[model samples]
Target: MRIGVLGTGGMAAALGGAWARAGHEVFVGGRDGAAAEALARRIGGAGHGTPARAAEYGEVALLAVPAGAAPALAEEHAAALAGRTVVDCTNPLAPGPDGVMLTTRAGESVAGRIQAAAPGAHVVKAFNLVHASVWDLPAGAFGETPPAVPFCADDAHAAERVAGLITAMGWSPMPAGGLDRAVYVEATAAFVIGVWWAGGSPRLAFPEPAHPSA
Candidate 1:
């Protein structure tokens, strides 16, 4: 698989490095050409270039930029991104006096906006729940069991492709319905961020909500 990473940030480096280690070709792109090239070398990427070039180089592209910048980046490379699977790992959250605040409007997720920006691309919301440091761990990152990552996508094929990538990177893919449900995933990220900020464990909050009676 050829993967393109559209940022030089932590998330971008983590995922790109994992995929590269899995024997997939990768390209790291960023606004700063030098930073992109440095990240590419660090991650064993096949190449490095501008975001547009990254979009053109891969069958699967990961948008790990800031949430506010995702739309413009997507729009700028819409032509190259068309007909490709685009994975969104952005969380629209900022630290506030109270806790983390969601930057997106009600009912609108960063992934959704990115989809609108590049209407022809298959936008899948994923890799937003966990911290980038977690992705740096080996196959069994979470002690005995690998963590499950919930993703939402309107395109079944694209979803499956992204799921495969997630699995390759050592995570269990939990499909959270279609793209319409993506806002929920984004909200989950916000909630999780708040929990971390408050020094609480988000994992403890997620259990079998209710077990069915046998």
Candidate 2:
């Protein structure tokens, strides 16, 4: 698979590196040319260029920029991103007095905003729940079985393709209905982040369920 990553940040570096290691052709691009090039080299990506060019080069474009910057970047590359499967890995979280808060309009999610910015692109919301550093770990960052990655998107084909990619990366893919449900996922991130910051183990609440013998 050919993937284009838009950013020079941690998410871009980690996920892009993982994809490259999985034998995907990756191209990285960012506002900072040197940083983008450096990241591309580190990931052994096929190429590096401006964000617009990277969008054009991908069958699946990964928007790994900051959440606040995601919509603008998508809008700026709308033309190049048309009809492409664009994966949004941004979390619209802002620091609050106590913990993190999801920063969105009354009912909008960051993924929805990015989709609106590039109306022609199939934007899927994913990778927002885990920290970027987790991608640096082996296939299953947790213990034995890999944690499921929940995603939402309106385009079924595009969503399935992205889900397949996630499976290839050794994580379970959980389809979380259509695009509208993405807000819930984003909100969960805010809550989980708060728990993590508060020194609580959120994962404890989601223990492995016992299964009946077949």
Candidate 3:
């Protein structure tokens, strides 16, 4: 599988490196050509160039840029992204008067906005739950059981393909629902971020929700 990474930041390096180790071809791209080239070398990528070129170079494109910048980036590469699969790992968490909150507009997630920006691209929301450092750890660093990655995509084929990439990177893909549900996914990220800020374990609050079996 060929993957295009659209950022030179930590998240891009971590996930891109993992895929490269999994034997997938990775092409890293960024505004800073030097940084992109360096990351590609570090990850043993197939090549490096501008984001537009990377968008056109891969079967899957990973948008790991800041949430605030994603829409513009997506719009800029809309032509290259058409008929392509886009994996969104951006979280729009920002400080609020109350606590950690999603920076997105009501009912609009970063992924959703990206989809709107590049209407022809099949956008899938994923890889937003954990810190970039988590991806840097060796597989099974958490334990014998692999971690679960909850993702959402309206396109079934795109979901299946992204799930394959997620699996290749050593995670269990938990398909939450369609792109319509991505707002909730982004909320979950905010919730987990709040938990971490409070020094609580977010993992303890997942799956098998508490309810009376009546």
* Number of the predicted model whose TM-score against the real structure is largest: 1
Tens digits of per-residue lDDT, candidate 1, 15-111, equal 9998898789999888899999999999874699998889988789999899999989999999999999999999999887788888889998989
Candidate 3 backbone collisions, by pair? none
Q: Global CA lDDT of candidate 2, please?
A: 0.90
Ranking by lDDT: 3, 1, 2
Model 2, 1-214: lDDT tens digits are: 8999999999999899888888899999888999989998899745998998889987999999889999999999999999999999989898899798988976799899989999999999988888889888778657788888899989988998899888878898999988888999999999999999998988888875588463
What C-alpha lDDT do the candidate models reach, one value each? Answer: 0.90, 0.90, 0.90
TM-score of every model versus the real structure: 0.95, 0.94, 0.94
What digit string (tens of lDDT, one per residue) describes model 3 on residues 93-171?
A: 9888777988888989989899999999999999999999888777777787788899999998899988898788778
| TM-score of candidate 3 on Cα atoms, chains taken together | 0.94
RMSD of each: 1.5, 2.1, 1.9
In candidate 1, stretches whose alpha carbon ends up further than 4 angstroms from where it belongs are none
**Candidate 2 wrong stretches, greater than 4 Å:** 208-214
Better candidate by TM-score, 1 or 3: 1
